[model samples]
Target chain A: MADKKTKNVFKKGAISSDFIGTSIAKHQSKTTIGAHNIFLGQVRADVIDNKTVAAIEYTAYEDMANEKFHAIREATFKKFDLTCMHIYHSLGTVKAGEICLFVFASSPKRKIVFKAIEYIVEAIKADVPVFGKEIFEDETHQWKVNK
Target chain B: MTINVKYFGLIAEITTCEKERILFTKKNVSEFLELLYLKYPSLKNKDFQVAQNQELVSQDALISGHELALLPPFAGG
Candidate 1:
């Protein structure tokens, strides 16, 4: 039951770097996995119709986003034998080409960790309620959800 | 009663404010939307979602005096 409780971590808005690092350290155990896989998502500067995107502003319906994130974390744990997992997303304003999300998963072996990492990242992109705003160098902006 | 309504993304652009309190009938979600649309006709066709008290709900869902938010389709990484 304690193991089940440790599998999911969700918070409103962006997660700090210290939180991500500490979460991994807390889950480290002798009986747990020897290998951990992490995936970090960052925004990129892309030109759309001759306008270059300078940065991205991230936002969320905080109440709903938090609920959805927690639900997804629980679902991921049930689907896999993960020793632990962590997910963090940005909120408010994040510049283009900046880090937006960090996902880390560890298990008992290489195979499970690899599979779990893929699953968690995919689930976050597909299911989470976080949204992004694409800011152009020209000072215009547009909102986008990860696809 | 007057309830506070929050707008995000493109919806904020139309409303010109992030939060506002409007006089509304104590009606279901759909009825409130009808009133909102009448006030901001430009929002009638834009693809957006709604949430009450931080929970996502369908347009026709029932709501009463809860915090409401209008979210345009999300574009986050």
Candidate 2:
């Protein structure tokens, strides 16, 4: 995505497989992009003290998170010869084994997309102010922190 | 100045409100945080970063924005 316009990367609930498929299909007209890399963040069913996580409810400082996403998009463009990029993150409740985050990057060369995708995802994990509450099977919840 | 302070994640759980308007006559972020600690004592023990006008600011940074946010650790993917 171009940095000239700020795009709201947050999506409600889990990002559907259909949406992701549609996004990939949309780029067919952009013939310049030869390589594409994607990163999908899935919620794990981690057991802590015998309680298993069932889902994650997300929240964010929307205005700031959008700003960080925009910065990351701009930085990725500056660092790589990327043709386009799209980032979508889930908000509200996302169940286990569901998709919560999707980062897609495209470039002319395979190597550029590989490095660009990782860079965008890592920056998102560190810079964005999006919060997650891990809800257990028993309904108890705990705040999640990036390790 | 009246600042609109917002709390997120566990920090909001402590404040029990997402956002509020406070009549703050503080000099810096630390001073403003002291006021918040007095109002919500549990917030003193929590870890967070202050954002002035949607940008992260240091504790020593002066209170210059009408909008402020208390953000906890990022778990975003």
Candidate 3:
């Protein structure tokens, strides 16, 4: 069994394009990986009740969140044939239009990668104990809920 | 026995603290929740779930783990 100890999936803030680029560039050496699908979750400036969101402050039960991520990763591996996977989420404040979550999956075939990406993302949304407080431009806030 | 209860999100706002340690007996989670509601009546109407040792648990489940958390709905991507 793979060590199931929690793996930290959180970065301190918004995921940078440079970091994502570097991640993809490093995978070039893995010639066996024929398909790589990526999911990037960007924060949206949602307007509600005449308030426009400016940013989001995210928090999580860190220990539990990491454990859940590990479990999800293992489940994805068991359900699909894949070469590698990477998941990342942001902690603290992330502005609207910034990337907050990133999931990357690689496999030998295109079909597996496509299905695996959606599965992994939905699992993260429902299972992880992360919370987001959306801050509006006027300093009001609201808790976010996944649909 | 004494257990540590951690609160998150709006629950923390109601409790005015992130965590607290309290004395408890060996019983089902529902009973423990009753005690919590007595202490923080505002929590009685709040929507949340219980996690024992980092696992989502039912109210009928036994309370064994030292770490217990009150979690609100998740909103992650």
Candidate 4:
């Protein structure tokens, strides 16, 4: 359980281009800060044992994923002093070499934004309850759950 | 008693189905897992976690005739 005083700032489900763009625009303010660091995680077509990955299909236990995402968001805010932060992860099918996650953090200083971005990305990858299915070029598929 | 159990990731592959109803006398999550491991010996070394009613729980948590989901660690961007 998280502390009641913390605020939840994450949105679950497949993130669309519009949502990503809008979140950035909304978080941009004159009084906020001077620097914003963004981390975009794009899927890659990796050759695994002579087989190239074609696409990745993502699935989630919705209720649990949402809870976990909220917890992560709150924890991130507590760990860093930032104006705002946003995390979006793809939920359905994402092709190789396409964007899968977009993380944005803004702060008054450039140094803080850089450190916050790194921390957020690491936490999301290590804690969130999201799964990916890797499809090979030949159409063979493999589920990729985090280690 | 029979309880519904759900599987995810590699565990799903071994069970060949994502969900099932198993009849067992186990009273806690750990005992249930021990029974499952006996039935599916291949799951001995696989990494997984348990959740009851969508809330993550420790292996020693008490669970009886409740909906539970087994999830492998997440691998998403």
Candidates ranked, most accurate by DockQ first? 2, 3, 4, 1
Over A23-76, each residue of candidate 3 has an lDDT whose tens digit, in order, gives 999899989989999999999999999999999999999999999999999999
lDDT of 1 by residue, A1-147 (tens): 224332323344445667768877776554657778888777788888899888777766666766766776788788877777766777766665566788877777888878878877777776555667788999987777555
Q: Candidate 2 regions off by >4 Å?
A: A1-3
| Winner by TM-score between candidate 2 and candidate 1 | 2
Better TM-score candidate (1, 4): 1
Candidate-wise lDDT, in order: 0.73, 0.94, 0.93, 0.77
Candidate with better DockQ, 2 vs 3:
2
TM-score leaderboard ranking:
2, 3, 1, 4
| lDDT top scorer | 2
Residues A1-147 of candidate 4 have per-residue lDDT tens digits of 223343333334345678778877775554656788989888788898899998888777766666776777777778877877766777777887777888888777898889888888888777767778888999988778555
- Native-contact recovery for every candidate? 0.54, 0.96, 0.81, 0.69
* Chain A (alone) TM-scores for all candidate structures: 0.80, 0.98, 0.96, 0.82
DockQ of every candidate: 0.48, 0.95, 0.88, 0.64
Indicate the DockQ of the complex predicted as candidate 1. Answer: 0.48
With a 3 Å backbone cut-off (N, CA, C), the pairs that clash in candidate 4 are A146-B74
Residue-level lDDT tens digits of model 2 in A1-147: 454479999999999999999999999998988999999999999999999999999999999999999999888888889889999999999999999999999988999999998899999999999999999999999999998
* Residue B2 lDDT in candidate 1: 80
